[model samples]
Target: MKAAQCSDYTSTNTYESVLTVQESVPTPNLEYDTPPAGFKNPMLVRVLSVALAPGDVRVMTGDTRELQGPPSMPYTPGGDVCGVVVEMPKESKKKGGWSFGVGDRIAARFVNKPMGMLGEYALVSPDVCDKVPESISNDAAAALVSSAAVAVIISDYIKEGDRVLIYGAGGGVGSHLCQAVRLKGASYVVGVGKDAKRLKSKPISCDESVNYTKDDAFNNKEWQDKPFDVVVDLVGGIWPKLVDQNQSEKSIVKSANQGGRYLTTTPDSAIFQGRSVWQILRVFLFPALWRATYTRIGFSRSYRPQYSYVIGLPSTSDIVTRTLSLAEEGKLIPCIDDSGPFPFTTEGVRDAFRLQASRHAKGKIIIKVSEK
Candidate 1:
């Protein structure tokens, strides 16, 4: 089978040196590598389309080398896939399962690991795989899995009439987060990002948009009267502290009302893609130091908002299913970047990764894995 394999650690975050097309990459056959002991057994899925996300980019670029370690040489590099079930063993059918079967169009995101979805065949289990609706395009289904799932999680924390602030609101997860929050009945949704035009281009349902490049991104007097009920920090680390690292950036966090929640999808070095070893270490260690510093400095932390990390849900199937249902109902839309879908060829995958690493994609990057 043909697969876009990561030949080695990417020299830079762009994945130019690491990703290459290779034939003869062994395809997964349920006969050899069965699903886990108790995971409803195995189902063989023929890759159709795949989506690019920051997590996939980080893995290829060695940003996660210290934590996830490097994939063995020639490892396939992808996380989200939309595919068709080519083979389903009778034993694979659990008595009270989702009834997944051959020919079912499925969308799944591989759990964080070296496991790849770029290959021709992917071994999927009931836990992470969800049957995508006929109304959803394969490209959209592939793009919806990971980011939409995170958006679902973030929305769960918001309540009706809540004033929500979504940082990085123009990117994949941020775009979905805006829509999800609106669906959750947020009274007002403010999207903050570097590109106001891109934010306005997507139907993200944000009530207002803030361009961080401007002098008063979120600190303007216009925002002073309206405090946020929830702050979703999709862009974390020093980004929140960029305008002013010495003290907490009021624009990023201080706007949150007391007792409100502050959520971040990225909580560690995960967001720092091959930037520098020192930078990665600082991010990994800063959380602890930040907590201690707050206590030692005797800083009045009474008004500190609840800080939490949006670790992906244990079972992504639920969110994936809900996202697809919303898509099928036309209540939600998958935000595929304007750059459009990349071909399934090796050069296509490489180019997609380069665009993703650039951190400026207006929406999800879709890879056309196979034709309908």
Candidate 2:
């Protein structure tokens, strides 16, 4: 099988040297006996399409090796995949517990693995897999698997008539998140990103778009009066920036209504640069500690919104099914980057990673691995 392999976490300029398209990578075998205790046995899939994620770039650059443990050399990197099941576990066929069979089109997000869904063939567990609807294209399905699952989880936090604010609102998860909050009946949605035009366009359609390059929406007077009820920060560094030495009260905290929920997907701005245990702990604990103690113990009664670092977990099959149904109904749009889905070649994959690393991609950067 042909697969894109990374030789090492080297400099981005040397991607051509570090990354290669190999012709004879061995196919993964299914373990019927050792199928992770309760999980179903793995299925061999014929890759159709794959989506590039921030994590892919992080891993390629050796940014997350300390936290996630380094991958073995010459590993394939991709998790969001849309593919067809070429072979199934014998037990799955005999027990009849599997929802899908050989030849079924599926989308899956493989977790905690080095050899991921970026090859001509890959093995996937059923737990994180979902059947892709006929209405959804392979590229779109690949794009949606991980990001949309996270968006759906985030949407659960939204309440009817709540005012929502999203940081990094033009990327993959951010785009899906924008639509997810709207679907959950948010009264208003404000999106902050570099690309204001795309954030306010169709699919994402944020009620208001803030270009972070031109303006500071957090400190702006315009949003001072209209505080948000829910703030989802996909980009880090905002929380620390919220504190102003000049102001008695943190003005950025004032951007959110009292008791508003502030959820962040990353611990800090250095997430991709490499995070120390202390740095990670500070980002995770500071807000919680402040909310729990500082507000109550201090002379001032002013309170910042509740803060949390949210990690997107592997979604259940039910959530995946619902997400696909929503996409099928045209209620949830899988936002692919305007420049992609890139072709599945060595150079094509390299370019896709370059776009993803640039952080300017309008939405999900997709790689078309094979024809549908």
Candidate that would win on lDDT: 2
Q: Tens-digit lDDT track for model 2 on 81-119?
A: 899999876555333476777899998885654236788
RMSD of each: 4.1, 3.5
Q: How far does residue 323 in candidate 1 sit from its true spot (Å)?
A: 1.4
Cα deviation of 20, candidate 1, in Å: 1.4
Top-TM-score candidate index:
2
Q: How would you encode candidate 1's per-residue C-alpha lDDT over 88-139 as one tens digit per residue?
A: 7557344566746688999887664534678788776656778888888898
TM-score attained by model 2: 0.88
TM-score of candidate 1 against the unseen true structure: 0.85
